[model samples]
Target chain A: MNIRQKVSLLLILLSIMLALLPLTANRSFSEKPSKLLAEVLGADVSVTVDEVAEFIVREDPDVRLIDLRPADVFIKEAIPGAVNVPYSEFIRSDPDTWISNREVRTIFYSTGNSEADYALVYARGMGYNNCYIMAGGITEWVRTVLDTKFSGGRITARENALFETRRRAGEMYTEYSSLPDSLKAKFLESKKFSAKKLDGGCE
Target chain B: MKFLRQYPFVLIVFLLMVVLVLFRSFGGNNFRYDAARWAESSVKGSNLLTVDQLSAMTGAVLVLNLGDEADLPGQLRPKTVIMRPESITGKENLRLIRKHRGPVILFSDDASTSARVWMILSEMGMRDVYILRDPGAVAE
Candidate 1:
């Protein structure tokens, strides 16, 4: 056979192999993986900070929020439920200190958007499909809630902040108004701080 | 010109594969050794402790290799905080270590932390110690 014919045949074979690759092993069932992965994992592959903050607002977000942040930032203002799961130790049998059964949605986040995203992708590659990335992460949440700017969009940032302030002024209202009265008191008292959901999607 | 200089592409590919295999093996060796040692134990003269047996050694060992978030029963309590070495460091660990008294099983997942809290705790006579120093498993 001519060299061109042989190379063309080889290319065709390679194309066929590549086409079947995903179907065989790479086939992933991540629900809306791109949008969700994109939402959590930014261009460089880290989850955003705002996503982490929203987690603090989750109804019962307590899936061990691991702060895969650098040591320096971790010291400054590590969120209440966050335990630093520094990325340096990739092979640490128990990567994170809080190993409460992977059953508990172990949502991961970081100070930067890309760091957490890479970890999430790596974890997903390692067969950990139950993990998630926090939306916007702590940075966004702090900016929206703490700094008071275009937050929920329904109300002005100042108005939203004022509402939280007024509510807290009356009494630390942790549990929402929709919750039972007894639970409201419990939440208000347990300002210990916690939330659930990985800002990212399940891989 | 580049192809000529970088000739023997197949050889290069084969070498890459070999390097990758070695790297992967090196990565998991430490944990594999620990698992092996544990498996070797519980075998007085003949019987060996399977992984199941070894894990069972850590009584009430809750394996979190499953779902996302779980709700523990109001009464459930974990006595031991088995953790990898690189979990935390410095002042952060100082605050955390003092909080949990249950023996913190430090599985040498990687290099030890420079956390003085861990050092102080080690010196303070807090024992329930099991340090598996496996050089092969460089969780780096």
Candidate 2:
């Protein structure tokens, strides 16, 4: 066989092999298993409920809280400023659509920790290193941040600051959660529209 | 020989592609199941098995305890292997999991840990793997 003929045959063989492989063209983990595991199990992968409260009070633009609960439950109540990305939808759909900005820190929280932890692993496995979990989910938030009370005779400056943040955050949560369904729907719609505008998308 | 001499660049590129394909084919790091499939099973709650359900099963079940020894129940002690969540992807651990014939169950005191470990194992293409759910735990 001619050299040209051999090269052509090799090219055709490689193409055929590539075509036959069960390639997951979308939604497969890109990170090495060990590395992703290490990151997920690391100490820095979770933030305390107090820290999330502080974020809410300060209106931190760099942080995005994701509520991984059912849509109806989210509409009833959620952490102030948290956007609902139901766990099932988050897993089924392309995560890039929900967690588009790599610069922002995305924190996942469910009613408990299971869904959030799953999301953290899935996102990090897909090469989104900016993901984290709110340690002890919304249940913990309700326990620590929402029901916070002062029993001490005298409060230190640091204690005062912490309580202040929690109080403000709790107030915001109550106000948002207590809104009527129609108003809540409008608020969510407005937030969605603003988010689209920020993304440079048209109506 | 003539082709190598005449078209070194093309031959080199072809060789590089061949190496990549081989590496990917043999690489243990790649995910076996797609995200959609994992999501389907997860949403359906088919990947979770409670302790009561596990007790009823009459098969050779391999339980992987990803938490403290004290956390594991008394009945599951015989066939259980205590493993750290982070080491699950290690060469030896992967081999042990792959070699096991029966269904493999992952348990942890923290439900999140089990959930995360289950997804990782599922993505690696391991079948018949399940998370041992606590009866008291609330479903998300």
Candidate 3:
């Protein structure tokens, strides 16, 4: 075969790969995945209602709040600044439609729990970082967001614990100390690059 | 002549697999679970989208709670919901196959619900329908 044929075949294969690469891409989460994945990543994934509150208050840019419930339910009630993008829509790898700012931190949540978690997995497969799942989803959000007391529905105790942990914190920047020595240098030098959450759907 | 000269079967298999993955992901959660597990392995080392990972992502066996007709949520019509345990009678949920107007996706083990759904939709004079059976059930 000529070089042209080989090149064309190469292009065809390349295009196919590009299309399918993130077919299972996920960016955020609802449930912490199994232990093997959790240990390797060492990232705090569950987005408790209280963390949702903290994320909103501090305006953490590394976080983005996405609601994966159906449009009508989301229209009725959602986290203040959370954006509504039905989970079904993430069938494509494109995050631009759901997320306007690529680098901003994002979180996805739902009343059904795993719906947003599944969506976040698919988002990560799409090659997005800085995404997470709100652990108990909107059910927890309704408890913590409105009351600040973490009451109502089936909100989890672990969620409240995560909130308390953040509250007792000395320096948020200390999280970087856990990073490898090589990456820590870059992280410290670039103080402006620290992670923060985005608006969780406010009017 | 040119088609035969293409860079072997491995490349074709790769391309075909990618398309099927796209189709399955969009279709529903009936596949790709085991494959996603394998792909997840060495995730820190190399993030390759392999066939095993695709299977894991696709192999989703979901059991939706159709509940009883009386308990159906919201403005949804009676015929629209798959099967309601209360509305269905008898022990054979297979009856749901008779009542449903559209394709009946069965997630429940309740036989009475199945039979009732079947009868109602059939009485409504609907066909061209199908039943998405539970993965556990023996094929009829």
In candidate 2, stretches whose alpha carbon ends up further than 4 angstroms from where it belongs are A1-25, A193-203, B1-26, B135-140
* Each model's DockQ score: 0.02, 0.44, 0.06
For candidate 1 chain A, the 10 contiguous residues with the lowest summed lDDT are: A24-33
lDDT of 3 by residue, A166-189 (tens): 443312323323446556444435
lDDT of 3 by residue, B1-140 (tens): 45544566546665677678666443221222222232231122132222233224322222223543333223223334443444332334434444333333333344223322322222223332222233123221
DockQ, Cα level, model 1: 0.02
List TM-score (chain A only) for every prediction: 0.46, 0.85, 0.52
How many residue pairs clash in all the candidates, one count each? 38, 0, 77
Please give the RMSD of candidate 3 to the true structure. Answer: 17.2
**Higher-scoring candidate on lDDT, 1 or 2:** 2
Per-model root-mean-square deviation over C-alphas: 19.1, 4.9, 17.2
**Recovered native contacts in candidate 3, as a fraction?**
0.04
Docking quality of model 3: it rates as: incorrect
lDDT value for model 2: 0.83
Tens-digit lDDT track for model 2 on A141-196? 99998897999699899999999989999999999999998988877877651233
- Candidate 1 regions exceeding 4 Å error are A1-61, A90-100, A149-203, B1-140
User: Which candidate tops DockQ?
Assistant: 2
